[model samples]
Target: MGELVSTPLPTQFGDFLIKTFSSGNEDIPHVALVHPEVDFSKPVLVRIHSECLTGDVFGSRKCDCGDQLHLALNQCGAEKGVLIYLRQEGRGIGLTNKLKAYQLQEQGMDTIEANVALGFDADMRTFVPAVAILQSLGVDKIKLLTNNPIKLEALKEAGFLTVERVPLIGEEFDSNRNYLNTKREKMGHQI
Candidate 1:
Protein backbone atom coordinates (compact mmCIF):
# COMPACT_ATOMS: atom_id res chain seq x y z
CA MET A 1 0.00 0.00 0.00
CA GLY A 2 1.02 3.58 -0.65
CA GLU A 3 0.16 6.83 1.04
CA LEU A 4 -3.01 8.14 -0.53
CA VAL A 5 -3.66 11.40 1.31
CA SER A 6 -2.59 13.49 4.22
CA THR A 7 -4.14 16.35 6.17
CA PRO A 8 -4.30 18.07 9.50
CA LEU A 9 -6.50 16.66 12.26
CA PRO A 10 -7.21 18.50 15.48
CA THR A 11 -8.50 16.47 18.37
CA GLN A 12 -8.81 16.55 22.13
CA PHE A 13 -5.49 14.80 22.48
CA GLY A 14 -3.68 17.27 20.20
CA ASP A 15 -3.15 18.46 16.66
CA PHE A 16 -1.93 15.71 14.35
CA LEU A 17 -0.89 15.21 10.77
CA ILE A 18 -3.07 12.38 9.56
CA LYS A 19 -1.94 10.26 6.66
CA THR A 20 -3.95 7.57 4.92
CA PHE A 21 -2.36 4.57 3.23
CA SER A 22 -4.32 2.38 0.91
CA SER A 23 -4.09 -0.19 -1.85
CA GLY A 24 -7.12 1.31 -3.68
CA ASN A 25 -9.59 0.99 -0.82
CA GLU A 26 -10.47 4.58 -0.14
CA ASP A 27 -13.18 3.73 2.33
CA ILE A 28 -10.89 1.63 4.49
CA PRO A 29 -7.40 2.97 4.24
CA HIS A 30 -4.92 2.38 7.00
CA VAL A 31 -4.41 5.65 8.92
CA ALA A 32 -1.46 7.24 10.59
CA LEU A 33 -1.77 10.05 13.16
CA VAL A 34 1.57 11.76 13.54
CA HIS A 35 2.48 14.31 16.13
CA PRO A 36 3.98 17.48 14.68
CA GLU A 37 7.31 17.25 16.50
CA VAL A 38 7.92 13.53 16.14
CA ASP A 39 11.64 12.87 15.73
CA PHE A 40 12.28 10.09 13.27
CA SER A 41 16.02 10.21 14.01
CA LYS A 42 15.47 8.59 17.39
CA PRO A 43 13.55 5.47 18.38
CA VAL A 44 10.08 6.77 17.63
CA LEU A 45 7.20 5.90 19.91
CA VAL A 46 4.63 4.02 17.84
CA ARG A 47 1.36 2.22 18.31
CA ILE A 48 -0.03 -0.06 15.62
CA HIS A 49 -3.72 -0.46 16.38
CA SER A 50 -6.26 -2.55 14.52
CA GLU A 51 -9.75 -1.20 13.94
CA CYS A 52 -12.50 -2.35 16.31
CA LEU A 53 -15.82 -0.84 15.37
CA THR A 54 -18.05 -2.24 18.06
CA GLY A 55 -15.72 -1.49 20.89
CA ASP A 56 -14.01 1.57 19.53
CA VAL A 57 -17.00 3.44 18.21
CA PHE A 58 -19.95 2.04 20.09
CA GLY A 59 -18.22 1.60 23.42
CA SER A 60 -18.97 -2.10 23.55
CA ARG A 61 -17.90 -3.60 26.83
CA LYS A 62 -17.21 -7.04 25.43
CA CYS A 63 -13.56 -6.10 25.01
CA ASP A 64 -11.03 -3.46 25.94
CA CYS A 65 -10.23 -2.34 22.39
CA GLY A 66 -11.71 1.12 22.78
CA ASP A 67 -10.05 1.70 26.10
CA GLN A 68 -6.68 0.63 24.81
CA LEU A 69 -7.13 2.78 21.72
CA HIS A 70 -7.85 5.91 23.74
CA LEU A 71 -5.01 5.16 26.09
CA ALA A 72 -2.62 4.78 23.18
CA LEU A 73 -3.86 7.99 21.64
CA ASN A 74 -3.37 9.85 24.88
CA GLN A 75 0.15 8.52 25.24
CA CYS A 76 0.98 9.28 21.63
CA GLY A 77 -0.26 12.82 22.01
CA ALA A 78 1.63 13.34 25.21
CA GLU A 79 4.88 11.92 23.86
CA LYS A 80 4.68 13.34 20.33
CA GLY A 81 4.56 9.85 18.91
CA VAL A 82 2.94 8.13 15.94
CA LEU A 83 -0.19 6.03 15.95
CA ILE A 84 -0.80 3.69 13.03
CA TYR A 85 -4.41 2.63 12.78
CA LEU A 86 -4.71 -0.48 10.64
CA ARG A 87 -8.01 -1.46 9.06
CA GLN A 88 -7.91 -5.05 10.16
CA GLU A 89 -11.33 -5.30 11.71
CA GLY A 90 -12.06 -8.06 14.20
CA ARG A 91 -8.57 -9.46 14.05
CA GLY A 92 -8.87 -9.57 10.24
CA ILE A 93 -12.11 -11.56 10.04
CA GLY A 94 -14.02 -8.47 8.91
CA LEU A 95 -17.02 -6.93 10.67
CA THR A 96 -19.84 -9.34 9.88
CA ASN A 97 -17.89 -12.44 10.85
CA LYS A 98 -16.84 -10.63 13.98
CA LEU A 99 -20.50 -10.18 14.91
CA LYS A 100 -21.06 -13.87 14.27
CA ALA A 101 -18.16 -14.64 16.55
CA TYR A 102 -19.79 -12.49 19.19
CA GLN A 103 -22.86 -14.65 18.86
CA LEU A 104 -20.75 -17.72 19.43
CA GLN A 105 -19.21 -16.03 22.45
CA GLU A 106 -22.70 -15.56 23.89
CA GLN A 107 -23.15 -19.27 23.48
CA GLY A 108 -20.43 -19.84 26.11
CA MET A 109 -17.29 -19.79 23.98
CA ASP A 110 -14.28 -17.60 24.55
CA THR A 111 -12.95 -15.28 21.86
CA ILE A 112 -10.51 -17.86 20.48
CA GLU A 113 -13.12 -20.64 20.49
CA ALA A 114 -15.59 -18.41 18.74
CA ASN A 115 -13.18 -17.52 15.98
CA VAL A 116 -12.00 -21.14 15.70
CA ALA A 117 -15.57 -22.41 15.49
CA LEU A 118 -16.16 -19.91 12.72
CA GLY A 119 -13.30 -21.59 10.80
CA PHE A 120 -10.79 -18.82 11.33
CA ASP A 121 -7.57 -18.50 13.26
CA ALA A 122 -7.53 -17.13 16.79
CA ASP A 123 -5.91 -13.98 15.37
CA MET A 124 -5.59 -13.49 11.64
CA ARG A 125 -3.93 -10.06 11.53
CA THR A 126 -0.55 -9.38 9.91
CA PHE A 127 1.89 -6.65 10.92
CA VAL A 128 3.40 -6.31 7.45
CA PRO A 129 1.48 -3.14 6.63
CA ALA A 130 2.53 -1.53 9.89
CA VAL A 131 6.17 -2.25 9.17
CA ALA A 132 5.78 -0.85 5.70
CA ILE A 133 4.18 2.33 6.99
CA LEU A 134 6.96 2.87 9.50
CA GLN A 135 9.60 2.24 6.84
CA SER A 136 7.95 4.63 4.44
CA LEU A 137 7.99 7.27 7.15
CA GLY A 138 11.74 6.76 7.65
CA VAL A 139 11.31 5.08 11.01
CA ASP A 140 13.71 2.25 11.81
CA LYS A 141 13.81 1.90 15.58
CA ILE A 142 10.65 2.17 17.68
CA LYS A 143 9.18 1.92 21.12
CA LEU A 144 6.04 -0.05 20.25
CA LEU A 145 3.11 0.34 22.59
CA THR A 146 1.32 -2.98 22.80
CA ASN A 147 0.37 -5.92 24.97
CA ASN A 148 0.55 -8.49 22.20
CA PRO A 149 3.66 -10.62 21.98
CA ILE A 150 2.97 -11.18 18.30
CA LYS A 151 3.51 -7.46 17.61
CA LEU A 152 6.89 -7.53 19.35
CA GLU A 153 8.03 -10.60 17.46
CA ALA A 154 6.63 -9.29 14.21
CA LEU A 155 8.61 -6.04 14.44
CA LYS A 156 11.76 -7.89 15.48
CA GLU A 157 11.40 -10.36 12.59
CA ALA A 158 10.86 -7.44 10.23
CA GLY A 159 14.45 -6.31 11.05
CA PHE A 160 13.75 -3.29 13.25
CA LEU A 161 17.07 -2.71 15.02
CA THR A 162 15.75 -1.44 18.34
CA VAL A 163 12.16 -2.59 18.85
CA GLU A 164 11.33 -1.91 22.45
CA ARG A 165 7.89 -2.96 23.64
CA VAL A 166 6.02 -0.54 25.88
CA PRO A 167 3.15 -2.14 27.73
CA LEU A 168 -0.29 -0.53 27.40
CA ILE A 169 -2.62 -1.53 30.16
CA GLY A 170 -6.29 -0.58 30.33
CA GLU A 171 -9.05 -0.68 32.87
CA GLU A 172 -10.91 -4.00 33.06
CA PHE A 173 -14.59 -4.54 33.66
CA ASP A 174 -16.77 -7.52 34.50
CA SER A 175 -18.27 -7.44 31.04
CA ASN A 176 -14.89 -8.12 29.49
CA ARG A 177 -13.21 -10.24 32.12
CA ASN A 178 -13.56 -13.49 30.22
CA TYR A 179 -12.45 -11.85 27.01
CA LEU A 180 -9.40 -10.45 28.71
CA ASN A 181 -8.67 -13.82 30.28
CA THR A 182 -8.91 -15.49 26.88
CA LYS A 183 -6.52 -12.97 25.43
CA ARG A 184 -4.04 -13.32 28.24
CA GLU A 185 -4.23 -17.10 28.53
CA LYS A 186 -4.97 -18.45 25.08
CA MET A 187 -3.74 -15.73 22.76
CA GLY A 188 -0.55 -14.91 24.68
CA HIS A 189 -1.45 -11.25 25.14
CA GLN A 190 0.46 -9.59 27.97
CA ILE A 191 -2.74 -8.15 29.43
Candidate 2:
Protein backbone atom coordinates (compact mmCIF):
# COMPACT_ATOMS: atom_id res chain seq x y z
CA MET A 1 0.00 0.00 0.00
CA GLY A 2 1.06 3.56 -0.65
CA GLU A 3 1.20 6.53 1.71
CA LEU A 4 -1.45 9.22 1.44
CA VAL A 5 -0.58 12.83 0.65
CA SER A 6 -3.10 15.39 1.79
CA THR A 7 -4.27 17.84 -0.88
CA PRO A 8 -7.30 20.09 -0.92
CA LEU A 9 -9.49 20.14 -4.01
CA PRO A 10 -12.63 22.16 -4.58
CA THR A 11 -14.66 21.02 -7.56
CA GLN A 12 -18.20 21.54 -8.84
CA PHE A 13 -19.31 18.46 -6.93
CA GLY A 14 -18.11 19.95 -3.62
CA ASP A 15 -15.06 20.51 -1.47
CA PHE A 16 -12.91 17.42 -1.09
CA LEU A 17 -9.68 16.41 0.58
CA ILE A 18 -7.78 14.76 -2.21
CA LYS A 19 -5.29 12.16 -1.00
CA THR A 20 -2.74 10.94 -3.49
CA PHE A 21 -1.22 7.57 -2.58
CA SER A 22 2.20 6.74 -3.93
CA SER A 23 4.60 3.78 -3.56
CA GLY A 24 7.92 5.59 -3.18
CA ASN A 25 7.59 7.10 -6.62
CA GLU A 26 6.40 10.43 -8.08
CA ASP A 27 4.80 8.69 -11.04
CA ILE A 28 1.08 8.01 -11.45
CA PRO A 29 -0.40 7.62 -7.99
CA HIS A 30 -3.78 6.36 -6.90
CA VAL A 31 -6.14 8.99 -5.48
CA ALA A 32 -9.03 9.22 -3.10
CA LEU A 33 -11.50 12.10 -3.32
CA VAL A 34 -12.95 12.42 0.16
CA HIS A 35 -15.97 14.59 0.77
CA PRO A 36 -15.71 17.12 3.59
CA GLU A 37 -18.85 16.17 5.41
CA VAL A 38 -18.19 12.45 5.72
CA ASP A 39 -19.72 11.27 8.97
CA PHE A 40 -18.41 8.19 10.68
CA SER A 41 -21.69 7.68 12.55
CA LYS A 42 -23.05 6.38 9.28
CA PRO A 43 -21.36 4.03 6.86
CA VAL A 44 -19.14 5.89 4.43
CA LEU A 45 -20.30 5.85 0.83
CA VAL A 46 -17.55 4.82 -1.55
CA ARG A 47 -16.82 4.32 -5.22
CA ILE A 48 -13.82 2.57 -6.74
CA HIS A 49 -13.28 3.85 -10.26
CA SER A 50 -10.50 2.46 -12.42
CA GLU A 51 -8.70 4.80 -14.80
CA CYS A 52 -9.95 5.22 -18.36
CA LEU A 53 -8.06 7.96 -20.07
CA THR A 54 -9.90 7.72 -23.38
CA GLY A 55 -13.35 7.79 -21.86
CA ASP A 56 -12.65 9.82 -18.73
CA VAL A 57 -10.47 12.63 -20.12
CA PHE A 58 -11.38 12.63 -23.80
CA GLY A 59 -15.01 11.56 -23.41
CA SER A 60 -14.72 8.63 -25.75
CA ARG A 61 -18.02 6.99 -26.60
CA LYS A 62 -16.48 3.53 -26.74
CA CYS A 63 -17.09 3.02 -23.01
CA ASP A 64 -19.28 4.23 -20.16
CA CYS A 65 -16.36 5.14 -17.92
CA GLY A 66 -16.76 8.93 -18.16
CA ASP A 67 -20.46 8.78 -17.45
CA GLN A 68 -19.95 6.38 -14.55
CA LEU A 69 -17.16 8.60 -13.20
CA HIS A 70 -19.36 11.68 -13.28
CA LEU A 71 -22.19 9.78 -11.67
CA ALA A 72 -19.91 8.41 -8.94
CA LEU A 73 -18.45 11.83 -8.24
CA ASN A 74 -21.81 13.57 -8.16
CA GLN A 75 -23.40 10.97 -5.92
CA CYS A 76 -20.39 10.67 -3.62
CA GLY A 77 -20.18 14.43 -3.28
CA ALA A 78 -23.85 14.71 -2.47
CA GLU A 79 -23.68 11.97 0.18
CA LYS A 80 -20.31 12.91 1.62
CA GLY A 81 -18.70 9.76 0.32
CA VAL A 82 -15.21 8.76 -0.80
CA LEU A 83 -14.30 8.03 -4.39
CA ILE A 84 -11.13 5.97 -4.87
CA TYR A 85 -9.77 6.36 -8.37
CA LEU A 86 -7.30 3.65 -9.30
CA ARG A 87 -4.81 4.07 -12.13
CA GLN A 88 -5.64 0.81 -13.90
CA GLU A 89 -6.14 1.92 -17.46
CA GLY A 90 -8.14 -0.23 -19.91
CA ARG A 91 -9.08 -2.72 -17.25
CA GLY A 92 -5.37 -3.23 -16.55
CA ILE A 93 -4.24 -3.55 -20.16
CA GLY A 94 -2.11 -0.62 -21.25
CA LEU A 95 -3.33 2.12 -23.62
CA THR A 96 -1.65 0.58 -26.63
CA ASN A 97 -3.28 -2.81 -25.99
CA LYS A 98 -6.61 -1.12 -25.42
CA LEU A 99 -6.37 0.58 -28.80
CA LYS A 100 -5.45 -2.73 -30.40
CA ALA A 101 -8.48 -4.31 -28.71
CA TYR A 102 -10.54 -1.46 -30.12
CA GLN A 103 -9.43 -2.44 -33.62
CA LEU A 104 -10.55 -6.01 -32.92
CA GLN A 105 -13.82 -4.67 -31.56
CA GLU A 106 -14.31 -2.81 -34.85
CA GLN A 107 -13.92 -6.10 -36.65
CA GLY A 108 -17.03 -7.54 -34.89
CA MET A 109 -15.54 -8.98 -31.67
CA ASP A 110 -17.03 -7.92 -28.34
CA THR A 111 -15.00 -6.10 -25.70
CA ILE A 112 -14.03 -9.23 -23.77
CA GLU A 113 -13.37 -11.15 -26.96
CA ALA A 114 -11.08 -8.45 -28.23
CA ASN A 115 -9.18 -8.52 -24.97
CA VAL A 116 -8.92 -12.32 -24.92
CA ALA A 117 -7.75 -12.23 -28.51
CA LEU A 118 -4.95 -9.96 -27.38
CA GLY A 119 -3.95 -12.46 -24.61
CA PHE A 120 -5.57 -10.76 -21.63
CA ASP A 121 -8.40 -11.55 -19.29
CA ALA A 122 -11.83 -9.97 -19.55
CA ASP A 123 -11.16 -7.74 -16.55
CA MET A 124 -7.70 -7.37 -15.07
CA ARG A 125 -8.58 -4.61 -12.62
CA THR A 126 -8.79 -5.37 -8.91
CA PHE A 127 -10.18 -3.69 -5.78
CA VAL A 128 -7.16 -4.38 -3.55
CA PRO A 129 -5.84 -0.81 -3.77
CA ALA A 130 -9.27 0.56 -3.03
CA VAL A 131 -9.47 -1.66 0.01
CA ALA A 132 -6.04 -0.49 1.14
CA ILE A 133 -7.06 3.15 0.80
CA LEU A 134 -10.23 2.60 2.77
CA GLN A 135 -8.28 0.82 5.47
CA SER A 136 -5.77 3.65 5.55
CA LEU A 137 -8.64 6.06 6.03
CA GLY A 138 -9.81 4.05 9.04
CA VAL A 139 -13.04 3.15 7.33
CA ASP A 140 -14.21 -0.20 8.63
CA LYS A 141 -17.45 -0.28 6.68
CA ILE A 142 -18.94 1.44 3.66
CA LYS A 143 -21.94 1.81 1.40
CA LEU A 144 -20.35 0.84 -1.88
CA LEU A 145 -21.62 2.47 -5.08
CA THR A 146 -21.11 0.10 -7.96
CA ASN A 147 -22.83 -2.08 -10.56
CA ASN A 148 -20.14 -4.73 -10.43
CA PRO A 149 -20.68 -7.57 -7.99
CA ILE A 150 -16.98 -8.30 -8.19
CA LYS A 151 -16.34 -5.12 -6.25
CA LEU A 152 -18.82 -5.95 -3.56
CA GLU A 153 -17.51 -9.49 -3.17
CA ALA A 154 -13.96 -8.28 -3.20
CA LEU A 155 -14.66 -5.86 -0.38
CA LYS A 156 -16.16 -8.64 1.71
CA GLU A 157 -13.27 -10.93 0.88
CA ALA A 158 -10.88 -8.19 1.91
CA GLY A 159 -12.62 -8.00 5.34
CA PHE A 160 -14.42 -4.67 4.91
CA LEU A 161 -18.01 -4.74 6.05
CA THR A 162 -20.26 -3.56 3.24
CA VAL A 163 -23.22 -1.84 4.77
CA GLU A 164 -24.98 -1.25 1.48
CA ARG A 165 -24.59 -1.61 -2.26
CA VAL A 166 -25.72 1.51 -4.05
CA PRO A 167 -26.31 1.03 -7.74
CA LEU A 168 -24.58 3.27 -10.30
CA ILE A 169 -26.46 2.90 -13.55
CA GLY A 170 -25.40 5.10 -16.43
CA GLU A 171 -27.30 5.78 -19.61
CA GLU A 172 -26.48 3.56 -22.57
CA PHE A 173 -25.67 5.04 -25.95
CA ASP A 174 -25.26 3.30 -29.29
CA SER A 175 -21.50 3.49 -29.10
CA ASN A 176 -21.25 1.69 -25.75
CA ARG A 177 -24.40 -0.40 -25.71
CA ASN A 178 -22.57 -3.50 -26.79
CA TYR A 179 -19.82 -2.90 -24.31
CA LEU A 180 -22.28 -2.49 -21.48
CA ASN A 181 -24.30 -5.46 -22.62
CA THR A 182 -21.20 -7.62 -22.73
CA LYS A 183 -20.43 -6.62 -19.17
CA ARG A 184 -23.91 -7.50 -17.97
CA GLU A 185 -24.55 -10.67 -19.91
CA LYS A 186 -21.08 -12.19 -19.97
CA MET A 187 -19.13 -10.64 -17.11
CA GLY A 188 -22.05 -10.49 -14.61
CA HIS A 189 -22.21 -6.72 -14.21
CA GLN A 190 -25.49 -5.35 -12.92
CA ILE A 191 -25.55 -2.56 -15.55
Query: Quick one: best lDDT, which candidate?
Result: 1
For model 1, the superposed segments whose C-alpha errors exceed 4 Å read: none
- Residue-level lDDT of model 2, residues 1-191, one tens digit each, is 65558878999888899999873345888999999778867799999999999988999988999988999999888889999989889999979999999999999999999999999998898778888888988788889999889889999999988988999887789999999899999989987
What lDDT would each prediction earn against the true structure?
Answer: 0.90, 0.89
Give the range of the ten consecutive residues with the poorest summed lDDT in model 1: 21-30
**Candidate 2: how large is its RMSD?**
1.3
lDDT of 2: 0.89
Q: Which residue segments of model 2 deviate by more than 4 Å?
A: 23-25
**Can you give the TM-score per candidate against the true fold?**
0.97, 0.96
